[model samples]
Target: MDPRQLARSSVPRSLPEARHLRQDDRFLLVTSIMPKNPAAVAHGPMLIGVTINVLLMGVIVMQAYEYFTSYKRRDDRYLKSLVVFVFCANILNTGFAVADVYLALINHFGDVQYLTVSTWLFVTDPVIVGTVACSVQMFFAWRVQVLTGRWYLGLLTASLALGQLICAMLMAWKCHQYPAWADFVKFTDLIIAWMTTTILVDVTITIILVWYLRRHKTGLEGTDQVVDRLIRLTVQTGMLTSVWALLDLVLFLTQPTDASHLIFQIPMVKMYTNSLMSSLNSRPKPKVFSEVTDNIHSIAKFVNHRTTMQDGTMQFASSLHPEAAAHLERHELGEFQKKTIEAASSGCKGDAKTGWDNAARAI
Candidate 1:
């Protein structure tokens, strides 16, 4: 210690030989400050995740580019706009998460950062990511409504999105003022409970959506082939997101605070990057004329509207296939296609080639 400096405080510096004293002033004289434990520090690289985030950012930019391309080409305006909006929100959320990690890294408190990002980032940043994430969920459901022209799934999706947003925000608020929430549990347990609930619900909801898409009417003869592909991509993206959610919850719940969070969170970020990939590939496919009416009526009659064809549109014949009976019995388009094809086959109206004769020609 400097002599003049020590004189102002009237504390003598402890030399190597005299450093054994256990007194508080003696301790202060020996070392001016005590640092947090080294065990909590984040260190070393986790290449897999960092690499993935790098790729995801690339994908987000690409999706935005694709959306613009579709509009420039005068393709389907609705799907293009949907893609742009979803991708934009994803990029914003991902940026905030990545930035939060970087801030923790540069703050020189890697240990604290490693164990408490859910608190540090979740609580402090006003939670734009949660908003975006739930919006993406609502988008998934809304697209289904667009295809079926029914509002049942859209309403359900909207409700779930709202619920998720509330829970995420509540947890963030609890962390922001831990004192206000009253330190109700051990820090580790508290965080684990929060993570478990959030991730589980997210995963379950994603699984249900994927299942719904797989069973929906989409095929060359049944539904738009293009829409089917988009549905699949959305489900796949949702499934991947669920996987990350589970992993994040488990790790944060099980691992000690001193564990290398950089090692894991980067991977968590990577897992999260799939939203960008899904968004970029989300453009609507080229339309094929094949149609099946009422994909969701089979699940449950959420809406009770009578099915009818428009006045100017051509109504087709039903098929002999077993699927035809169910299609005709339930919805107007199914009967129209079955009859349209039948007449074409029986040599009564349009040629078979233009009608059901080549149902396989669907895009």
Candidate 2:
């Protein structure tokens, strides 16, 4: 009783003094409640993800600039429009990511409650990613049909792509419904389906295209060299996205308590857009025509000499002319080679140019 009465009597009576004490107590309460290292799990990954996303955005800008400057007249209108669409979508995705990070870590600094909740910006990521991926996959599917002349294969690829897109949209809607980060596990099935389909579509496209390109080798040194290069590129570009997607899925499943998966998810759409641009930009130029001309001369020589019989009789033997035999027996001369032969025989440089243009697109 005596000690309590003494303490109460010593308390500050001025309003300013009491207000200062209240502020000090408030500061102590905040420090006590705050986690020792909130950034490790929540803000740090987002910051790193956003940083990488921005770097990729810069790369995309450079690639887009190059595409427009170098292929302005060379690319068809549809291709040009696709480039524009992907570029715009990437910009939108990056913008939302930046905003999401800024709002959580900057505007609401030290707000633990705010950091624990998901926002609309967070939901946009899956939607934009699905759109860009589907567009690229559909483009490849159309190419598969054009190159392989197998409509059913293309349809299968397109179907997988569409399934992934639907899953992505559903996942986004579920994420929106569950704005709490802790509740993300509720939609784990959707995430699994989306990432699984993404991986499948990427692998399927890679395998189908690689198989077709390998089969496309004409045995001629020059043409086979081109096909080999295409095969390497298809493997590299296709596996890149698939590998990253797998990593993202693995991290999401293993580190369910953290946002580490965002590291790969943030820059995913950029990878797709860059892969497409790289493919378009890497198309063989007029310089390749010289090699094609050399190939044509070699073929002509082989056809002329090999088709002549040993008895001085000119007899066309299918065995001696593999290209023609492929054209006749197997009908396996791909669109690119068929066009190349027709253009060369017709002596139309314009058609030859068209054939060369179709070569990379056929991949």
Candidate 3:
């Protein structure tokens, strides 16, 4: 064969073959550069949702335990009704959350669009969670007011709580109106305001409680122990909730496409309710300290004679031990009778008789 003939044949006579190879190269480049839905940041929220539901279940169990053990015995008709309302709201919240998971993942597994599309299940979440949050915060505001005898604290906290609740409701309404998960980022300002207000309210409550408890500290050893306990409890509960809210806000702002915010948002109601129940139930039971020491009588008298003043529509008490005063104001006088009894009881449990006697003498 001639050299020219070989060159001409080798030049590739088919134009379509050259175009197909070029297209294949382009396809490979695009596929390599662009992220696939499954491999990219898709499952972050789905996995978070599952974990959140598990935690929510635990919260409900704890709520039930607290209610049966303490609230049932401690609350009157009105208070018990409030407990019932909160519990019922939690049930609804959990139901809707599970439904959201089902719709977004289990029911429409392969459908990527469903994940970013807001449905009725997602729309109702803010309403349910916001209502629960508002009720709990307002309750805390009233309690803090009673504890500190400061009407302004309650008013301020309640105002923030109301603001957050309103923002949440408005956010939810926007979700319903737009009906797209992607559209939610458009209301980022409202979401930030909602989270910021809740965080402020929580931190403010913590500061007020801790400040009041510290201010009222009697130099007495037993009284100091009780005050320390109150301060620790307030800090732990208040900080945990506020920190979770902060984390949610951070994730929402940084990873708007990921539903990682749900992780912190889901169990917040449980935090509030559990904090309330713990505050109520942790007041030493009378029988638990009945045999401990004679200091109980003096503490009992102090709690019984807690200072009271009428302020507008509310009547509250003020005392060196504000926790005791809060119990008294709520008509939980039996629980109040042993406010420092646990401290006294612990003090009396020393191995040496002299230690018990010294503890008794100190009290």
True-vs-predicted CA distance for residue 332, candidate 3, Å: 3.2
RMSD (Cα, Å) of model 2: 8.7
Q: Give the TM-scores of the predictions, in the order they appear.
A: 0.55, 0.77, 0.73
RMSD of each: 9.6, 8.7, 11.2
Cα lDDT for residue 159, candidate 2: 99
Assess each prediction's global lDDT (C-alpha) against the native: 0.45, 0.73, 0.64
lDDT of 1: 0.45
Question: Please, what are the lDDT tens digits per residue for candidate 3 over residues 225-317?
Answer: 767877888898788878988998998899876556777776666666666666655655445443334333444335435433244211223
Worst 10 residues of 1 by lDDT: 298-307
Residue pairs with colliding backbones in model 3 are: none
Between candidates 1 and 2, which one is better according to TM-score? 2
lDDT of 1 by residue, 1-363 (tens): 332243234444545544454455554553453233322333333233445555766766765665465434543455456555655655665566556555545653434324333435434322544555565666555544543445776676666667666765765666666632124234555455544544554555555545554554423333334335545665667667666656655655455443333344444433433564355445332231233323222211111122223553333322122232223222233234445444333432343334333332211
The model with the greater TM-score, 2 or 3, is 2
State the lDDT at 79 in candidate 3. 67
Q: Rank the candidates by lDDT, best first.
A: 2, 3, 1
lDDT of 3 at 16: 40
Q: Give the best candidate by TM-score.
A: 2
What C-alpha root-mean-square deviation, in Å, does candidate 3 show against the real structure?
11.2
